[model samples]
Target: MAVKITGSTGGWNCDFPRRQYMSPLFSAILLLLGLCLANAINFTTVYEWDKYDFVWPSGVNTSNEQIKWNVYFEYMAVFEERLFLSLEPFRGIPATLVWFPISGTSTAPPKLAPFPSWELHKKDNCDSIQAAKGMETDRDGRLWVLDQGSRNCSSKIWIFNLLNNDTTVRVHQFPDAVVSPSFDKRSLRDIVLDKTPDDNLAYLVDSKSENIIVYSRKTNKSWLVKTPGRKWVSLALSPIREERQLYLGKSGYKELYSASVTDCELKNEGRSAAVKLIGEWSYQPYRMLIDSSNVLYAAFFNQNYLCKWNISEPFREQRIHEVGEQDTDWPFTFALDTNGIFWMTERNDTGDWTKPRHKLLMAAVGARSYQFGTSTDLSLRG
Candidate 1:
């Protein structure tokens, strides 16, 4: 009495909906069926260095001399239920990939597997160059990889999905010629699934142009979310805003801009339209997530720090969590999960006056709830 489900690799069965057909075997398979549902996601403290706990399938650390690299994790996504991580490297290819799963409180560290070596040249559909700054997955399970095209002026966005019944790979190409309005066509920092409030259509962020090209499965006509003042790469829908607007942050720079998203259109240069200056440091603000309390958690690439901004209140005081030194393992990209924990990619130091030249390091920070401490029961945890 096991229910069969088709998976990517092989077929597996769980005792559930199929038990009705064979009720006699249900008693024997009840325990096994419970394990299948419980093992969906479990977290573990397997990654322990000194005092901090890490997420699973961490990067292989070379040069065991307590070395930490300062680089950026440009792209991050959950691919096929496994975590796909990439980083900025030096002397070799600029990209590396790590495969793992979403870890929970009962999860274990991912077992190490043989990784395919970084390729140097472009092959058929999947290019092996470097500088993969952004990555996003479509609802249909297609992966869209955005390469910086840094080395050869190859400002291109590559799309990859499975063909031949999910065996052979397929690719689609879009050149920079029909992409944007800016001349600094170096990198597409990040990709977001744009969900319009009014309709079922979504769009992707074209960072260089300070505009987002809207794509609808319903109609083929395209539109743009234009911001007149500055360019934006990281976009997040604010949870605390009254009108439920979109908050956009600049990539590779220190700035946070807000625009109301009504009917999937940006209400530009209006009274409700206001920009919040988090800081003036020159760093890339890559990925952002809105917490349950309406706070904006931002990760700065150049600086290994996690910035917390109170969007619900006036933007006067903001908290910054600097991890590594400017010349050390500065974070590049980061995300916060439902548990209020911060996950980031840590890179090796790119030497003084140099750039990042190492593999990836995964790190996490636990969030603690603080209360108003006084003569009351309100106390803060550190």
Candidate 2:
């Protein structure tokens, strides 16, 4: 005769409570399986910070007028032997793209060269591409702009052609896969140009969708790079193959992921895909860069530290570099030079979200690397 088994709300619904109906041996086996599953479901590990403090650009007053930049530091990229950055100023006017030469020394109020006519106000339909964040000049010298056009998510990719010395531009709306995934309208945050030996493509980071979109240079087709279960804050590419890492952060968990490129060309057709996982931890990592040597450096907001990591091995380990946290209630963004140096900006502790302001910061990755600490006149000049 076979024994019948059943389940109940109170406990186990035992139609066979006796040894004749259910053996003690089988009951012991079921108990062990239940305990094992419960253990697996309740597993979690907590990590704590031992030492946290600021180190570079010390003794600087964030309240000073000369260092104050009344906008959000959205993008920083190297272009034309210099670094070109864009700041999203509040109120009416479109954001400004400023340039500065790549000198090792920190310049006061950093010299601001004239923004190219393409970046200035224009009457083209592309004018709606507002609040430019990521600015990169292509091989053809056309400026690629990533606009964070608010949560309404009607953002696009705007191009400024430099061929005719004209500001003629084109704007491409966000692809359906990116904007339709969320009930909330999506907005893009940053874009990095991923250059292959044959061609170049743009990796668009949309924080709202928690994914990156890959756009083809030839087809202009867009595909999603899924970053499941994580809100990616910023992404930086290493100049090497299949080794790009993304700096991801959220309310309580902040991490960097080692993303491996998977797709490859088939029969003269160029195709690529990628998947990533958490590689390291640096709470509240807003922006970061990977140097040619594969070392990862990132900035932390509110925690008051600029952290570094070594990803030469399979697992990335953190190398904490203490940085100044004073008055920098919000450390928004950062950049890296060809020489492996790092730069950042700090938001003043106003506590008012309505008015956003930041002071520029400069630092080097090594000791005795950053000498010109806080030079007021040179901070924003660039």
Against the true structure, whose lDDT is highest?
A: 2
lDDT of 2 by residue, 18-56 (tens): 445345877755754453232111211111111111111
In order of appearance, the predictions have TM-scores of: 0.54, 0.60
Number of colliding residue pairs in each model: 17, 21
After superposition, candidate 1 runs with Cα above 4 Å error:
1-72, 79-81, 89-91, 94-98, 102-131, 137-144, 149-172, 175-184, 196-210, 213-224, 239-242, 251-253, 263-284, 324-332, 336-341, 348-382
RMSD of each: 17.9, 17.0
lDDT of 1 by residue, 122-235 (tens): 322245534455555443554555555444335444444522122213322334443542336534556544334343333345566656544343343345555556677776
For this target, which candidate reaches the highest TM-score against the unseen true structure? 2
Count backbone clashes in candidate 1: 17
User: Per-residue error at 11 for model 2, in Å?
Assistant: 55
Candidates in order have lDDT scores of 0.44, 0.50
